[model samples]
Target: MPLLDASRDLIAAAARRVMARCDELARVSAAQSGIERVYLSPEHARVNRLAAEWMREVGMTTRQDAAGNQLGRVGDPASAALMLGSHLDTVPDAGRYDGIVGVLMALEVVRLLRDATLPFAIEVVAFSDEEGTRFGKALLGSSAVAGAWDPGWWSLTDAEGTSLREAFLEFGLDPGRIGEAARQPDELVGYLEAHIEQGPELDERGESLAVVSSIASARRFQLIVEGEARHAGGTPYDRRRDALLGASEAALAVERICRAEHHIIGTVGQLEAYPGAVNVVPGEARLSLDLRGEFDGARDSVWSAISAELDAIMGRRGLRWTAREVHSAPAVFCAPLLQDAVREGIRSTVATTEDPAVIFSRAGHDGMAIGAVTGVGMLFLRNPDGISHHPDESVSEGDVARGIQSLAETVLQLAADR
Candidate 1:
């Protein structure tokens, strides 16, 4: 593979452009996701238009699907396409690089490819609603493309009771036409995404690149523990069935289970106690648990352990309880051929032994969603501190350049395949 000077310049320019728009985009994302105090707001339509314009500026033809996904095409429509891009939406108050990096890199790829002749078409996508912060549904755009959209999904409402369908209408997107976003199996020959590691794996190990093997299996659930409400001053410790205590016990069980299992992570991210007043005895508690493991059986074992612990705690405390499974996605392995290509891409970049390749990723990405339908590969640029999704997230300019080099090489190599 030959390195092109113009491609390097284009990638550098794209990164600079992204950095300049960081503050403005962050504010827009925060407001649209209604992330100040909630999960996310339905602002896919708003961001899609902005992304379309950016795509056009880079010489790519753009379009918005009914699912609110935006695609910018480079190369000929008749050729097999290699799609590169990421989601545009952010987590509530999320730092800029979470999803934006991949999207920008895709645009950069288009800009670079347009300057040269390529065998395959390249479609840069800005997928909508991958965070599930707004509609409680993750991977909305990718799911549509994968033919996984459920009619009932559009009927789901946000915390404020705004239906997703209505939100689409407000954005001038026809929810009824969402099915049109589905791609023919042959349309996408391969996919590549450049994303921040969003975890300590790369930084902690002093590795600059991560060729991901698989995405972790995740199970999300809500536990509701109910107990009698009483005045704090009037209730005796031994006589009261404290829901908070049971909830605490359950949380600890979750921690212990995760600690006992390798490559498994469990978090009780959200917890609410009724009568949160200091003087009142809590009557109800709601907690959300997110358990993940690299293997399916490991995840199931951890869930079982957690459930047993929750049951024992509830029984011992004499508290009524309920548990509901909210979402579960089995671990997904990246296609081996694509993985090998990514590895080759990494090796193609000249680097010191200090910048060796590593393989691990704890954070979920749009690539995981796309992998379900098509071959997908990812590249992780080094983050010295492994910090991401925050304002302080940083990556060296050199690493960015190397990553783009690797990406362009990989795309060119893949495009050469008949």
Candidate 2:
């Protein structure tokens, strides 16, 4: 748990490199107007080339894996590799930090230690896709590495109706060779990811960085309410069975119930009312519910309550309702020793009266999938105003410096353990 032995100058240099690289990658967007580097897109290839070039400059051997993941390795291939880096993919108009920062930070870590190779190997992985923006399934890159790639995903299509397999082929990668991306059990020491906090927690606590305890379990649901579509002017309020109105009540109940609980979040991210007509009442209303929590029990408990509330709401309005499960993922906890290494890394970078803050992420990460294969650890850098997935999302140079140092120190810390 002792502070990282690296000098301040090295940390500063690494920070500068990460900041410059982030700006450089921001320009390679799929959209000319804003950032939109989705999976298997041309922009994705452009960014990977840039990242791979930087990795090579830092004295690492680089390759673009079959899954389109850009990987850079330091030390002998025979050695057990400590996997570092984050996803390179982004949501449309995403902030410069989110996943890209982590990839750059990992490459910087290798650069900081260029003079002395660690006892084991270090690999920086620019995961091809984690946002799921194009294919609507997140962690596609990490899933392949974790040996969890679903063959069903091959048929998944983008907004343009192009299949995932077709996109892979067009991107100069063989979809049939995706299995080649999976890392064997003996190939890794562990996985470490350094990323922007994407929330106000660290900033609110007046800290630049913190260790993550767990990634939240999440569930997505589609709720639909059905009612008779009648003439709006003729159907009196008292006699009307309005599907939209019933759906609105259910949404409000979701917010109220979640707000009353601790660590549980429920959001209706999308909503639609059917039967397109200015005068006719909506015959059906459909809404998307995304619920997440630190624990599966808490998440499911809140979901069941929401479902019951929906039942009551529909019953009162004489509307028929149904709930469909869309997506579900269980929580992933950080390994205890990895948590200690990151905590010590934080300790090495800043002055803290209390213990270094540890947070449970409500937002998901590629770590969730990677954790299925090996131990995983995460370090979170502070983000101003907790903004992400937007052009205005920002992070400070000073925070980046601290984050780089913390991540480098974490590698050393874990190295000592082995």
Candidate 3:
């Protein structure tokens, strides 16, 4: 039977309901962190509870783990389980769709399976803290499930000095028991996630879905520039040792270098000057650099060139600087077999409609983190403006419906596989 024909109205209705709940969910997420700042706030706990309720309403069993990940399941538990889910957290002031869409889509998949009487079991998960909005550590929930959670991570704190372990405990979860969250490697038959493009690639290409091949490798660092602070009026431009100026020049140089190397992408996302005074020449500047590329070697080479440029620029300007590497993760390629399933699923959905979906994703997602442990596949709905991670990010209702149908069909195909 044709999948869309069987569940089109239900899919469309679910998307509408998901959109309707966006404001409530967003507000709740904002409230959770007590910051009212980001989408991944303490309210995410509320969102998880609501998700569990919704799963129950749809006749699925649900549970919450030590890391606060909410899991809703249907089908037989004895067989290898197919997991479909996405993170529930978001960056501060994040748009409603980023991680929410994936979670909602997973729920819709469960609803569809219940309606269709599919033979295999499906698990829907709302992973916590994928955004790292409060804790500055991304993929913590997924890492826990992958058996990669570090007990030492309990010492990690947020900007406010609240440890993640503390937060987990306060939320009625035991951090020491996080190891129990890990899934047995053989238990997972496959995994899938749906997410916003979070970039211009899909809208620019006019595609409805993207079959992600690999996630870009990423490296983040802090560049600290130090120079003597002096009176702005007393110091001549030639003689002044201005850290801010040197840092700005180095940042621009980094941008120029990355632009020159088409494969590498770099951003100086944050910059701060110490002892700010309108009349003082700034003596200390800290710049945070986020660099990414599809290839590890290419990313390393870009970093090498950027380091060289920073050294040359600082030395010529008589400034002392330190570069501290903060975070690094290698690029992740989707399993070829799972990729094929995604392509087939998308093609099945397209066969039912005149307009086919595009297939590609450039943004990092929980799928990438989970792919490290199990077979992971992803599907993306069309975003007219290709905007994400902000209030302005959006996806059309038609596109969402198509993605749901495609995902449901894909889940069934994978579930039926021997």
Worst 10 residues of 3 by lDDT: 31-40
Model 1 agreement with the true structure over 168-267: per-residue lDDT tens digits: 7877778878889988768888888888787777778666776888877888898999998899999899878888888988998899889988999999
Candidate 1 Cα misplacement greater than 4 A, ranges: 1-11, 30-43, 352-356
Candidate 1's C-alpha lDDT?
0.77
Candidate 3 lDDT tens digits, 163-229: 8777777778876788888887687877888887778777887777766677778888988999989
Cα lDDT, model 2, residue 340: 94
Clashing residue pairs for model 2 = none
Per-prediction count of colliding residue pairs?
A: 3, 0, 13
lDDT of 2 by residue, 1-418 (tens): 4445677787787788888888888888888888889999988988888888988998999999889999999998789999999988889878888898999989888887766657889999999889889998888999999988899999999999999999999999998899999987789889999988878898898878889999999998888899989999998998888889898898899999999989999999778888958898989999989999999999999988988888888899999999888678899999999999999888977776678889988889989999988899999988888888899888888899888888888998888777
What is the Å distance of residue 49 in model 2 from its true position? 1.1
For every model shown, what is its TM-score relative to the native structure?
A: 0.93, 0.96, 0.93
Root-mean-square deviation of Cα positions for candidate 2 versus the true structure, in angstroms: 1.6
| Model 2 misplacement above 4 A | 1-6
- Candidate ranking under lDDT, highest first, comes to 2, 3, 1
